[model samples]
Target: MTSIALIEAAAQRLAGPARRTPLLSSPFLDEIAGRRVLVKPECLQHTGSFKFRGGWSAVSALDPEVRARGVIAFSSGNHAQGVAAAAKGHGVPSVIIMPSDAPQLKIANTRALGAEVVLYDRANEDRDALGAKLAGERGLTLIKPFDEPQVIAGQGTTGLEIAEQAAEEGVSRADVLVCCGGGGLTSGIALALEAKAPGLRARPVEPEGFDDVARSLAAGLIQRNPRLSGSICDAIITPQPGDITFPIMQRLCGPGLAVSEEEALRAMALAFLRLKIVIEPGGAVALAAALFRPEAVEGDAVIAVASGGNVDAGMFCEALERFGG
Candidate 1:
């Protein structure tokens, strides 16, 4: 488990680089969920997601000499952008190994941020093996997206903010629904809440088919997703819960919730029409759970972390037309 002290240390390093994204609320959302809902719009974060915090934390924590050697990372999109932006900030080189089929916007943005982009076929190639090989050949540090302690601690900054911001809104106790991939964000936030606000419970929210975290929580063991490519929530869709992240989640989170693809799209559309914010499908899973899985949240107040907002224009338009106004 990532200690609160480590998370706080990461927070200190993140204050200069990461943006403290807003906690937003709307009367319409409240009515739909039938509870006072607070949203942490991490989509508005630097690099367009909460990954920036972890990226910066990992890069900045490196020894000065090691920082000069550069960093390597593997991500679908969000983490690519995060590591790219963070490496650029530190004046160090970064190499990102991403799937050839990853969202084009993310690939372009990673290049724009000055990272070398390596494309691999997700079905036939092993991203982990490729990343490690590249790191070894280039003498670069490999930054695992979710398994790293510093990365998890960096992500906990969001939980710290959620605890403080919720207090400001006269909310001391609320069910926190976090969009989860490999459980880094979920576990990080859960640990933060355990130390900062014990009254608030953290829950993992995942796409229906990729609900490995939910299953793992119920089974009391780490679980892998049966299939990784069927879901539209591409930003997530990891093969399994991370080894380091699973233990933290098991220790800190309650039973998880899973939402359908249609429900995620509906939540994305609702976020646009009601909250006036754009949220990616994977990022909207927590909001979808909060909106559609009412029984999962037992409190009067619910806080859903809208983790990212990086979608293609066509996808956004489709979500608007097919799901809501």
Candidate 2:
């Protein structure tokens, strides 16, 4: 869990580099969901995802000498890009271990950000093991994507901004539907909402077969997904919730919501067509829950966090053409 003070400091650190993504609205979506909807397009964020916030926060927080030792991370894409970009900004080297099956666009983008990319098989290989070996051998700092306090604090900055922005738009309260993977973003935002906007509730949204967060919330214990590789929403496909993130979510978030893969694809299509934004399947889960499971949410207004837009061109086109039906 991240402290409000840490999130506040992250906000200050990121003020210059991090973008204040727009809170978007669509009349078509409002009619479909039967409520006012505000979309936070983190797809428009640097490196095309919200992970950059935590990546920057973590990398920038390092002591100058420690930063000079470089950093290593394990991510499929969004976090890889975030860490690479942040390390580059600090003139520090970064090495990312990504699944071999991860989208090529993400792989290319990570390397393009000036990080060394090491690919491992998703089904047969262990990314954490490889990352640890590299970190030990090279004496590099390991920036765990969502488990680190600095990363969570950095991610909480988004919630702080959302609360401020929503207030400016005359929205005092809303159901904040966040796409959940390991619960880093969801937990971070939940803490922020707890402090800054208690009326605005944070809820975790996941894909049907991989709703570990949802199951854990229901069972009153941490749960693990049976399989990790089946979901189209790859960005949010962690095998289990984060150790640091789960407790915060358990305390601050309401019941989690799960959407079918089809619903996620359809939500991606709708976002591209209606909001004119490119959202990855994982990133669209919150919007899917809002558009498809509106009854589960409270209040007349909902805020959906579209967490990333790092999909490949082929997948993006396929979603737009086939899922729209």
Candidate 3:
């Protein structure tokens, strides 16, 4: 389990490497949401995602000899790039197992970051089995996307920042909406809020039809998504909330929120226009909930974590074309 102490240690390890992303706000966004909306743009983070913090934390926390043996991770895109970049920075080897249908830009970026990229059929192949085989053959430590203790601790560092930033902004209370997949980011933030910002609450946001975390939170139990591969918000798609993360969320988070893919795209368009930042569909879900689903959120303000920006040009253009007003 990830505790505040572990998160502090991860923050220490990440002090020099991870970017402390800013909390941005725009009057235009405020008008749309009918609340003061602050966005924590992790899209501007290293490797174009907040996943880098988790990747670097996990890799750096390993024993030096163990880290020297290399690391492996399974992600459709963002986490893969995060791990690959972190491994390269540490002068260690990395192998990324990604779905074949994952965005080409992510796969290409992973390879360019000096990792071996293995593509699998998402519908037919077992990614975990393949990752285990590779890790065994190469004596590599597996860096799980969200389920690992170190990874969750790394993600929690973002919540620590949110706590501090909200304090700076004089926001004693608000909902911190985070894009959710296997619940790593949301649970991490929830933990940080529990420890450091009792007045602030964390909420998980998901794309519709792939809202396992939202449904699970509503049910007070783990629930599975019926489909995993079809959403345009691919970065936040997972079969269910992670076993390690769900309980943390249950204990600390507010009710989860789900938004449509079109809403996510609209959020992407708005983020670009108002904040001048690019956001992928998955990363925009929290912003979507904040902007389009204001009634479901509480408080006079809301903070949304724009989690990643590793989007393909075509998809990004499509979003801008459709909703870039």
Candidate 2 lDDT, tens digit per residue, 6-97? 99999998998899999998999999899999999999999999999999999988999999989999876789899999999889999999
Residue 219 C-alpha lDDT in model 2: 96
Which is better, 1 or 3, measured by lDDT?
3
Candidate 3 structure quality by residue, lDDT tens digits, 200-298: 999999998988998998999999999877899988898999999999998889999999999999999999899999999999999999999989999
* Clash totals for all candidate models: 0, 0, 0
Candidate 2 shows a clash count of: 0
> Model 1, range 1-325, lDDT digits (tens) per residue?
4799999999999987889888998999999999998999999999888999899989999998988989999886899899999999999999998889877877889999999999999799988888888888878998889999999999999999999999999998888999999988998999999999998989999999889999999999888898988788988889899999998899889899999999999999999988989999999999999998887788899999999998888888899999785
Query: Model 2: which ten-residue window has the lowest total lDDT?
Result: 98-107
The segments of candidate 1 whose C-alpha lies over 4 angstroms from its true place after superposition are: 121-126
Model 1 quality (TM-score): 0.96
C-alpha RMSD values across all candidates: 1.4, 1.6, 1.4
Candidate 3 overall Cα lDDT vs. reference?
0.93
Off by over 4 Å in 2: 121-126, 323-325
Q: In candidate 1, how many Å is residue 240 off?
A: 1.2
> What is candidate 3's CA lDDT for residue 198?
97
lDDT of 2: 0.91
